[model samples]
Target chain A: MNQPYSSALLENAVNEFAKLPGIGRKTALRLVLHLLRQEELSVENFGNAIIKLRKEIKYCHVCHNISDSDTCSLCSDPNRDDSIICVVENIKEVMVIENTHQFKGRYHVLGGVISPMDGIGPSDLEIDSLVKRVSEGGIQEIILALSATMEGDTTNFYIFRKLAPHNIKISILARGVSVGDELEYTDEITLGRSIINRMPFNETFKP
Target chain B: MNQPYSSALLENAVNEFAKLPGIGRKTALRLVLHLLRQEELSVENFGNAIIKLRKEIKYCHVCHNISDSDTCSLCSDPNRDDSIICVVENIKEVMVIENTHQFKGRYHVLGGVISPMDGIGPSDLEIDSLVKRVSEGGIQEIILALSATMEGDTTNFYIFRKLAPHNIKISILARGVSVGDELEYTDEITLGRSIINRMPFNETFKP
Candidate 1:
């Protein structure tokens, strides 16, 4: 239903908010109304924050991850292993992996997976830069940390084939039932993969 | 968990987005990233729309509804009934009632209900303006179209008492089972009220 937004300004704000991914018109109205209720300075800050970020934000020249500088912090950090790079779909994956604190390597954000349905091909991603990074020769291993979807697998295989000539160790993320997941609730494909890729119990069972 | 946002600009934008009602950090990150993926001009438009709205929006002098001018469209319309006024909690309710195409009368937005928990007193709303409007002598009816919650009921009663001295006909939105609702699935109070306030068959029956 068309919202009877009495004010053109309110309508414009609501329309702009609705354009965001997953936000419906009703939700956009609610969000706009909530913003209206806020202090003018706070709302200004909210708008300015978005504008400023978009206007001035940079991507790492080395990894293509979002950064304030030419090179991202992770890529610049001397403590992180320069010999290993974790290749992922986007910066969100970098944050997720960092939160786990399990990976202490650099990241290479592909921007997105090679999805044919969405018309996102290999050229659209940072695959060429990734190949160039590997060809430069300090990297000993590449971790394919993309999502386990068909597009992710396709991207992973494409990267693997491109980097095969370099004689570097390339590995995809281990597929298994999640640590806290119940066996009964685990899907067939994941359960099957977990069984097939089972490691020695001693490696996982820490006393 | 702390997000390892490589850029402070990105982090600030995410923080601002997360401050919005119902938006969490992850969702904020996703939205911010989506904006980042859009064309620079589109992202600028999104930000500018919000800023422009907050900076320029005006409230109607007569009805307190959001408007571009001193008087709202509904209040200024010559065809709308001037004798009756629909008292609503906010502009959203006004829009909802208007969308129904039922109320030809103008609206008086209270801005909010009397909620002691939220520290919102009757004085905090546009109740004084409503009283002042009724005291001016042309209004014949006041329809309290507020929500059905205890706070709504309390506000309705308060408004009724306030408008009692003005000698105007006071009414409220009917509380009953909703249209298209199954009897078995309806709440006890609504079902009971529906039965108690059962209307004449001919009045409601179309076929």
Candidate 2:
């Protein structure tokens, strides 16, 4: 019950699986055993997937988002608003914004936020490329769509200061109650901000 | 933000990861991305582990437990009892009994229990090999240590009928209140059985 039987190959597979983030030895054992029962072709395909992902995947040169090619689909799109670039911390954030179908602009992935504890600074991000993209002309608005954390704020301010000299209008996502959020269950800080920054009754209905 | 960029290779990797037992689409993406961030050499090692597991692993011919060789460590050991065999559902159960260090007998893994609903019958298990092992004549006692489920009972009874003519002592694990189990929390059937089959107070203190 506590330990499965001894087999060098089984142990090797379990150890490899356990190396993944958040996976424990028990879960790794379970996963390996499950794979062991599958067809050899399927198991080999699973292995090849990981190997290919590491060896072949490349980041989009324009936005720094993970892609199979040098440039991502969004960056190469002719109809998208290249003038309004949405800045985010990672590629996942790009997906989040894309799901809303609200913004029809390109994106700039910072790779990560500036966290001193994690030794991440302004240089670690793609801020210089963003500034260069703006200075090339025709760019009118840039959206700071990072999270509401301290690191997000620090990164936003750092990019704002760098872009100020280029004379481009910069804006941020509005903070308020979520669309389906109930006031009673909402946290104190978010509820307070939503009340303090309450929009006009007519403005709420306009959108 | 919900839909990550479309890439055939990336989607293939994510789909392969999602095929694992407990993993979902979101978790598969996280795992694939985590592997992507690791060094290429390390990811290759992870992939190779699965390939090696599928290509090289073998099961013990004597007991049906997974092994790196033809015969398992337990079967080859000269110190273990040859007459008494502890019957179990799988290698995990063998490990459980081994951890106790109380039963010094050899084990015979049935591979699985008889389940008509799942299309697993007596033929699916290594029952013929087990009967052959018993007929060879050195087995003095056989302990049935399958789970306390309906399937377990059916398998046990079926095995009992097959081995009846062999004239070997057969026994089942005692069903009673589990150690450290509270009477109030214990199920009604188990409690009643425990009361009816109570061991002598002096016998309880012995081994």
lDDT per prediction? Answer: 0.93, 0.89
DockQ of 1: 0.86
> Model 2 reaches what TM-score against the true structure?
0.94
lDDT of 2 by residue, A63-161 (tens): 888888899888888999878999999877887788888899989999889999999988988999999889889899999999999999999999999
Ten-residue region with minimum lDDT total, candidate 1 chain B? B198-207
The residue pairs in collision within model 2 are A95-B1, A95-B2, A96-B1, A96-B2, A97-B1, A98-B1, A99-B1
- Report the Cα lDDT for candidate 1: 0.93
TM-score of 1: 0.97
Q: Across residues B8-117, which tens digit of lDDT does each residue of candidate 1 receive?
A: 99999999999999999999999999999888898898998998898888999999999988998999999999999999999999999989988899899999999999
DockQ of each: 0.86, 0.66
Best-matching candidate per TM-score: 1
**What's the number of clashes in each of the models?**
0, 7
